[model samples]
Target chain A: MRWFWFDRFTEFESGSHATSVKNVSLAEEQVHDHFPGAGTMPNSLILEGLAQTSGMLVAEYYDFQERVILAKVPRLRFHLRAVPGDTLIYRAKIDSIEESGARVSVTSHRGEELQAEAEIIFAHLDRHAEQRQLFEPNDFAKLLRTFGVFEVGRKPDGSRIRMPAHLAEAEARYRSQAQA
Target chain B: MPTQDEIFHKVQSALVDALGVDEDEVKPEATLVGDLGAESIDFLDIVFRLEKSFDIKIPRGELFPEDILTNADYVVDGKINDAGLEQLKKRMPFADLTGFEKNPAVQDFATMLTVQDMCNYVASKVDGKA
Candidate 1:
């Protein structure tokens, strides 16, 4: 199963970069599992959140046309442990985009305090060669919308980016069905 | 270079995998969303599969030209004028606009996009003609 660590995007720039937020809540199931009463958000989960943030940014470069798998964590540094009620702000910037893969620099913050930083590499998998679909498009689209990828996304020039026509139509259908 | 038939077959397979639709439903004339039940997210999956399959790069807004609607020069009185229509036609040469041209509502543009259109677009890109 695919994992979506981040909650939603607050700022999305197609191809170049993106920013998302994840609220670590006491109610999360993992919190109880990690510690019986402490309820601390694990540092690994924080790294996963950074991965989700940067992964989406890299995927958008191909218009989500390729399978972007996390290849490596060349570097990572954690400054603090997070508890419930802490909001993690993840920012990902493209270091370079290439045909083989992409390199992204990511940092996580907790309200003016640095929580963690990392450099991640993603491999663009050839789905055709694999002959396997990693995600159902409908489910993936809903995930993108739920994360506000299209709602706040923009071009480098600062113009609002339009959601692809097919995605817009699907979102409309989902909305109507949700209302019904 | 892959033949048009190969491209079409690959495109159909991609759509079937991405949208979870039957192979029989992915006909050339079938509308992706209308007939085949593709949602917006499916397009991303389809494009991704196609790019990986064909070993090509598809820029955002190239396969689906939503940016045209945002261009002021193309939209006049809330409708696409001749120039706008021409530009769209050039961008999406595979789409059949016969019915859309008759009515020309902004919504019709997306609705008019068909399975054959995507197949053609991928073919063009693979052939280095796009």
Candidate 2:
């Protein structure tokens, strides 16, 4: 089963930074299992939300040619616990980007109060070197679209960030298969 | 060759376009990261725009020195040594380092660089001095 940590991206700038939001809800199984009655979101899950926001930013820098994997959390601090009714807003800013890897500063907020802040590093893996596929292309494309990457993303000049031809083709194939 | 005014306008436009900031916000004295709200990722976008606008190739780490922190001779115990600071000032002449001299941490130098510094660097590169 595939897990998406973030609900949708509210802001996306190619090769730069992104902002996403996740709503903590009673419907989430983790909330029910966490305390049975308290209904507090897990701190680890909040970290995942940070990773997803920053990971996509790093991946977009490479034009999605390489697979970006979370390498480490060099620093992390939690100031508050998020409850079921809270809405978590995640903002990730790139610290440095190199050919092999990148670093990002991530912060999660619940209505202006800081919940957690983390510094994350990501390693770029060459797609060809890894024979095994981590994600099916069509599924990944669908995930990107659902995240609002294509809709809200823009270049430095305020122009729309276009989906690469390969991903577009994959999405087309996926749509046709669904229709068939 | 473009005039100084022309170069300034181009550099300012590039920064505005790259960082998604207003034209007035990208002043010569504004620090790119602190004042103009440029993230590390935005540096690449700014460089790309500069290259296309001016028809010049900016090698990695040339516009912004990336290797200074990793070099043992320049850094010690997370702080940039005096010699290293001098070397950095030499490389990035346009940057305002008056405050950085008091206590120089390797990590903090990038944030100290201002938009005017970048514009000057671009001018130098175009003039064949870089």
Candidate 3:
């Protein structure tokens, strides 16, 4: 099963905030057997959508130089159940970010109603050279494209955000290795 | 400058939000690990919330000194030596090391962090500014 919870990002501002949309559908595998006859999207998966939306924002803030991993969810409260046909909009705002990690405030909304809110944390592991391949820069860059991050992403100065050089280099190397 | 009680309350609120513990469970002498059940990751969460609540920049290693714990020179057989304890004391003046001084076990050090110590640490950071 794919871990892609969000469909596309409508708003992405590097480091500060980002908004993404997720369309719940019974056709998807995640909600197939959630309740058998009556399937509803798992709250955990909704949380994942929120995290991914925010995690990408945080990762882009540092130009993807650091390996970002979700460390904790300090607070999360679900106000409504998200079922098939519901379009959930997840918004993630960076409250504080530093070299060590970042703290993000995320919320999920269905139209005008607030579905969920949370405070999530991320930790950086750039110093771990041995585990550098874990992030798989090429695959990550592709994932960003699939999620439409680059299309809507912008820098703090309002300039369009560009893909990092490292990811491009990694993709080139991977293609060469595959050909070889 | 905020009063001691105000600092304690703010610290308490941060702990409650971070650890998902009850407001009453957070007391002066309540051990963060033992009583409130805060794991290593929760410390980062607590620090983040505290920074947000108090609006102060808490540089890494100021609130929790992980470096001393991990240093080979300080730790021996999963225990902190007297010299190590001295360094820890210098790093965390707000913490009362008298109790932990006896055991000085590395694992037990986390459990020694009482809520009062956190308040003291915040007080030291915010008070000195005033």
Candidate 4:
């Protein structure tokens, strides 16, 4: 509910797309007992990884007050098992947005391989209320500020990805860090 | 606050609830791989259960070498032996969740677990029939 699984928003574009990453480590307790000798990264968390990443996109669309939960996972598949040391890159492209909830097509990749993919539907809920809240006054500025919308990424060759104009300055700074 | 043994027992019971494996299958000495035959996704579902049950995050990391990850025997061969289990048990931090603010995933690993811990986690996630 708190988007506890993923962190570090590398690329966040307003009104369209987003990308986030979760670094997996071997020291995890689940790794030790998971299979004794063959501790593997769990898929649900990988799904959680994707959900948390995409959820951030949806969460950013609303102000921080709303908690986004996966109402339905219409389609999801695990192509591979991501291990520790693997950084899961979650990318979500918004298919549509409605008043009650929105739909997102999410992809989870471990480097080049598509680790998992899902079509997720998220319902927006108020933090205080038991049921979901229908709407809130739009806050584009707060979404950009809280979600670190300035950070951006590039292709291997160094061309910048598509992003909003306001984030251009932040993008330049991020590119410097990415290069460094 | 639950003592280590109590925590261990609670974890064991949770595994039985989730995975449905016999309690004897999840003893401290049991191997999660050769003894239990859990797949990777099974491990994930189990962790979610443990998190839900104990209210914790299992610290994550890259443990196995890249070449060995997909191999079935690596887990069954006791690659992470009792010595490793002891090291894992020692690493379970009793610190507050606030310590995890630096990295939320760290909360996932607060409890030092044995193969039994993994079993309980796996068991708790499943319908408790396996």
Candidate 5:
């Protein structure tokens, strides 16, 4: 099974904010049997969607170089549960970013109504975990490409965001290694 | 510059939000980790909130000097030596090191910060006394 919670990015602006959508469907086993009878999207999964939305945004700030992890959700308030068939639109905006980590304020909306609002803190593994590889650079870049980040992503000046060459080079290296 | 009460209030709010503790629980002498149940990750969250609330730039290792504690020159057998204690004192005058000076065990360092100490730090930063 995949850990993808959100479907795709509709708006992705570099160093600022991004919006992603998750369609709750009863076809998903968890939603169908979340309460045995009620077909509702689990709150935890909703939080995952929110996290992914913000995590991707934070990772892009460094061209996906830093090992960014969800450190804490300082604030998360849910107003209502999103049932299957309801689309949860997650909006994540970077509050601050520094060498230590970053803070993002996010909101999940069902159409025009707000479902949840959260303040998420992501910590970069810059200190002790510097020597460890949190993820394969190629897989990471491919995931970002699959998520349509480059398609909708824009720089601060409204230019299209480009994929980092290092990540692409890492992928090319991996492909050559496999072919060899 | 913000007054003492103003700084305290802001610090209190930041701790409350970051630690998910009650406003009444953030006493002047309450230790952040021991009294408020803050974890290592919470410190990062608290720092960001404090920075935002006070509109101040809190450089890493300023509020908490984990580096000094981890440094080999300062730590020996899980205890902070005299040099380490002195470095901590010089960097963190906002914190009262009298209690921590007795043992200077690196393990017990997390319990050193209090609500009032945080307020003092913010005050010093705002008044340019730090």
Candidate 6:
């Protein structure tokens, strides 16, 4: 099976982070089978959304090597039911990357409303069943160019932080939200 | 030589057939969940299709406590460990063999999927560390 939920990547960085989007619709049949009458997007899929976003980020780091899958999900939570007509924006950042594995944090949003969040860890191995290895950085620069980079964190004063150049506009957006 | 483009095209063909959508609609730009309307179960089916089509194993995992993010944060990181492979080696009830060829899930909103969902499922079944 594959992670088919992440539309395509809107932005990506091999070693740092990535971003993608998903547009949910009422026409989705899973909604009907899940609740019958109400038919809400399942929490598992929501998590899948996060995993896929982060998985690709990890894959880009590997230059789409063998393949990246969820080895384990240490934590997950669903704050609300995502119904049709909601466009979910997924963002993921690398917390750390090592030869054996990597860890990442993912967040989802619907027009500024905090929808979901998760932390993911991934390991890379060959399809031939060899031990895990460090993914290739062959496409790192090209991939990074495709998806711009951003800075995330908070200032000492408890204000949010942003990148100086790449994400200047995004930084302003987040800061504005912080003030609001 | 097996180029990435070949593999990508194969993946795309499986998606087009399994989802019953137009091949043009199956571009890399398409989002499985958002654009395709795929859900978890449907995603499982897509995995089965890809495995049969590509003859590969896909790593699979579920949510635990430490990986929770907000709803919009759909980023997960993990390699399909030994445990995950064992689970997938077992029967996959989520997949349906009957309507696979015609893309029973296509345009049905009942069955489209994002690319990542399909990839992870395939990753779960892969025998990466054997």
- Candidate 3: regions farther than 4 A off: A129-132, A178-180
Model 2 lDDT at residue A161:
79
- Give the better candidate number (3 or 6) by TM-score: 3
lDDT for each residue of candidate 1 in B13-90, tens digit (9 for 90 to 100): 887766778899989999988898776545655665677788888887887787887688988777888888899888
State which docking tier applies to candidate 6. incorrect
TM-score of 3: 0.93
Note the chain A TM-score of all models in turn: 0.88, 0.94, 0.93, 0.68, 0.94, 0.67
lDDT at residue B113 of model 2 (Cα atoms): 84
List the lowest-lDDT window of 10 residues for candidate 4 chain A: A134-143
Residue ranges of candidate 6 with Cα displaced over 4 Å:
A1-3, A126-180, B1-130
Model 2 chain B scores worst on lDDT over the 10 consecutive residues at: B40-49
Instruction: List the candidate 4 regions with Cα displacement exceeding 4 Å.
Output: A1-3, A126-180, B1-130
Q: Compose the digit string of candidate 4's lDDT tens values, residues A25-125.
A: 77876645666777677778778877766776776555334566677665788998778788888888776553445567899888998988987767765
Model 2 residue runs over 4 Å out of place are: A176-180, B1-130
Better of 2 and 3 by lDDT: 3
Q: List the residue pairs that clash in candidate 5.
A: none
| lDDT, residue A143, model 2 | 82
Task: Give the 10-residue window scoring lowest on summed lDDT in candidate 4 chain B.
Answer: B61-70
Ranking by lDDT: 5, 3, 2, 1, 4, 6
User: Which pairs, if any, clash in model 1?
Assistant: A65-B48, A166-B40, A167-B40
Best by DockQ: 5
User: Looking at every candidate separately, what fraction of the true A–B Cα contacts under 8 Å does it contain?
Assistant: 0.00, 0.00, 0.80, 0.00, 0.73, 0.00
Docking model 3 quality class: medium
